[model samples]
Target: MREAPPNAVAAHYATCTALAFSAVAVPFLPEAVLLYAGIQYLRGFLYGSRQWRAPARVPLTLGRRGYRDATTRKRGEATWPVGTADGRQVWLLRQDLAQGCAFQGDDPDWQAASIERLVFAACLNRMGAVVVQDHAAPPLAGRIAAVARPFGCDLGMAAIDLHASLTPPLHLTTSAIEAALGDLGLSEKAQELNRALSPVLRMIGTRHGLNALALYRAFLDAEALSTLSRGEYEIDGLTVNTDGPASADAAALVDLQALGEAEREEARQELAPYARELACTTGLSLTDGLDLGTAIAARRLTCIRPASPLTAVLVQALCCEALAAQEPVSGSEVLVHLGELHALSADTVRRFLTSTTAAGAIGTVALPSTPDATLMRLVSESCRIRFEHRSTGKQWHTHLISTLKDCTFSRDIEPFLVERSGKTGNI
Candidate 1:
């Protein structure tokens, strides 16, 4: 008798094995073995003696334009091309896996879910479940399975059984999968599983749910850095009351007076131009406006507890501006006042002035000195800074002096007026 072709001989043997199992109802035959027999029967019937072909390797590209699979026209809603340890290929199909699954990366639990899915796919493939949608059908399935068998040791029934024994449910959550793995002492498998799973997760699809969490974290970090860079490392000095009585601790009273005197000096020293300019602008005599502005500036500098040192300087400047009325202070005047008020180096003061000018908190002028020696002064007065209180629902002001302090200024201003309470004052 003529020898049959190798393909026919293999097919014939596979068919006999299937028939014998069917007749005896063997309990030990693996699902893949049964699938192997079915595939041989189909190949012999459909393709005859044609040699089995390797599956077409598809290149997956992820981009702004979305997912692209090189070999097939069919597109999954979400798809990923995964490589097995044995160099075999399995392209995962996206389904309702994401419907209830928390979004990847956003949810703390997603990585664990990813590991479980990888384990599930490997196990399912061993049980004759085709993990690759492209190779799920007749003619292709037979060839793919044949190619997969020799190195399918890791994808075998025993490994699959180990996973199933850990978790009984067909559907899994990240927590459930993790708990099962821990219970089964398969915790050691997690790192390898995660390494294998991460690439596939990236290859899969949409990150719609993860974007919000990422944005929030980014904003928080940026805000914190900005605060630090601005030297806002301490609590704002809140307005305190010293009117009731002297402190029981005599030392505290002395300390408070010393602090207040220091602030008063900061407010009054080197502020003559700012005071005079404001007085001339307000239709008041230069002497009267200057005197009044200096007093108010000193009072605010001494009494107002500012959130930051910068705020204290701003408040003092604002008080002087209020005295000036319609006249704006020159940049040089402000620079001089701030310079006298703070012990900061010239460079630090210049940087602060530059930043405040750019933010419109203060106005400036160009000086004629060489670039390094040149400096600017604050010219404008009557500036206001407004902000919303995120939690309190109260609108707040960070002006050189708050409206709450207007009453105190008014008392000071009365003495400077040409006429006070229908009577002539000393001014």
Candidate 2:
């Protein structure tokens, strides 16, 4: 033949040997990564857990989409070979998941994650299950439900997992899955699915012979079956609402690899300032807001509002846009996710929101109307200056509030003083 291509025999032999040894490897996920950044990851994990800001709290909106977009994946059933146990087909869950993931700037392989999720969904289809996830991806209410939706309907869920987030991870249990399944409102089939799958999961655990499965079996037995079998849950749900197909649009996809390094560098240079400003506004970082705000700011507005101490509405919008990014969230799921990032109480959040809404400060923030009202009253009561707003219904209040943040935490919230050359400027 045509001079049997160079290195063909050697390549073939090497490929054969590699494929033959595929089953031979690490004892655990840790073993796989140890040769790499195992020590670094461990160090980060130990130190990082302390940095979690908010205590674990329930999500409002049940992980619902705060806003809508205009895209649709429109995937058909042929691609999703794994239909519901009763054989109900779904739309392009893969594309939809990607779009939703785009909404969050996150992406996991739909085939694999969805397969795993569908297996669990298949197992828990009869009842709403509460699964303690031991998977690589976090078992957030929205994530699980996102994968679950294309699989079936009337599935409500809640999840409780161990602190083993410290470990690379362990395995999940049938009971844990069942718990999430039943914990939320699920269909009758959901319960039946879990009941059937629990034993099967045990058998699979026995087969894999991994500790995760063994522990999963133990967890299933640890507590009596919860009253998760109630059928009312599908109607009375807690969280995990999708932003739907409308939000599935709003993106223009391109290949980063397709651009030259020079072009990429130039683009980064141009976008850096916009990125920094957005990070400040959203309380996300440059990296996090890259997929969310910069694009919008560049295309729509030069600036955005609620720049700091981000309000609930802003958080909701950021979440919507962030989800569009399809990446993991930094500050979206914890205590801060519910809108309270500071020590401020609920009343304070409401008051600030009310004031901003009334003042038309939603798009552009100037200053507080009541910042120096006492001074205004004093000036009006005592002097004849008739000190009023300048041109734009804004005056010194603009300067103070605009400067308050820069003053407040810029240097540990410096104090402000009315008189004298220097006082510990209060804020």
Candidate 3:
């Protein structure tokens, strides 16, 4: 017989191995090993072969007139070339894997489901159940098997959450909030509770089945609200109770006056403007919005309240803008600035800036504002220096970003912005 060429000899051995597993060993396996090996062989030949000749590339031009990608097309009066730099035409290569890479970021469901699918596949293989009736058959059934195991899915989810591969917490702001909600098992229980509540929405006038279930299950006692501190959510100085007795402990009561005075000073202390121009623009006549702005400019700080809600800083910012602007600031104007600054809702902002009751909040937006706010602002600004005792105090000053050092006290507080332009306040 004629001697087989070296490549042909190698290919013959590979083909023998492939057939041995595909036809001979397959009969004994309810397991996926035989099938997996067979499919992988084809997969390698089609996609991962180093020995195979590269597919022929045909150049195609997508013009300034635009060609179809079937999903998105940039519409503009711009002309661009889509050919090779050497003047050779460029060819488009479509890769199945490349298409997957487009949406590489993980969705929430991926954590649990991906794990479940993987573990289940392994288990199925070990159990002699990993099977491929035909090489051409899709792997949907296998994927479904892996994804459907409850305990396996749960464990996978746990593993995902436990691994903090990339993200690190700055101050525990996000993690703290999540931890405070509850542990992992609680989340699953809560999900189950939500499913149980879905049919009762129209019966009880609640829309979110999950959230509504959580709320109802949260407190078993109706009187729980009264027993809890009602002041939990209110600002330090914001609440005034006309009807209730004091909740102060004996030790607290002893220093109540001193504490009260100190807190008053805190509220009244001229805070550093994020930027001077923002201060001036808000139109607070209290000591020239410029001067207050200057002090804040000196200090790269905003109102420091550990207890402050997410809205506290935002409202403070809105007020600053209103006070700075020379024109009468309508609610809409404040909302507009807020929109420009961050994507916060007008409703959330309204709580901090506007008081609908006849008696307005201490820091309501005044149309050219009442003279009283101006006078108070002026008096507060008149003080040469307003010192705040930060937790780190002097050392903390070093950590202050230099970018903020150049900023002036600004009325332009937002969720992310530290200061605004043109206004000056002392730190």
The candidate 2 region of ten consecutive residues with least summed lDDT is 96-105
84-161 in candidate 2: lDDT tens per residue? Answer: 211222211211111111000112232223223332322232212222221243334444444444445215232322
lDDT of 2: 0.27
How much does candidate 2 score in TM-score? 0.15
- The 0-to-1 C-alpha lDDT of every candidate, in the order given, reads 0.27, 0.27, 0.24
lDDT of 1 by residue, 312-412 (tens): 23333333333343222321121111211222233433443443343222221111112233222221121111111111234211111112211111110
Please list the residue runs of candidate 2 whose C-alpha ends up more than 4 Å from where it truly belongs after superposition.
Answer: 1-167, 208-427
Residues 1-427, candidate 3, lDDT per residue (tens digit)?
0122345444654665666666654565533444555555553443332221111122123322332222122221211111222333222222111111000111213222222222332232221111111111222333333333432322211110001222121111112222222221224333332222222211222322222222222221223212121221111234323134434222222321232333323322221111122122221121111221222222111111111122223333433432343233221111111111122233323432332111111121111112235433432332111111122332211011111121212111101111112222111
Stretches > 4 Å off in candidate 1: 1-78, 99-427
Residue 77 in model 2: shift from native, Å? 60
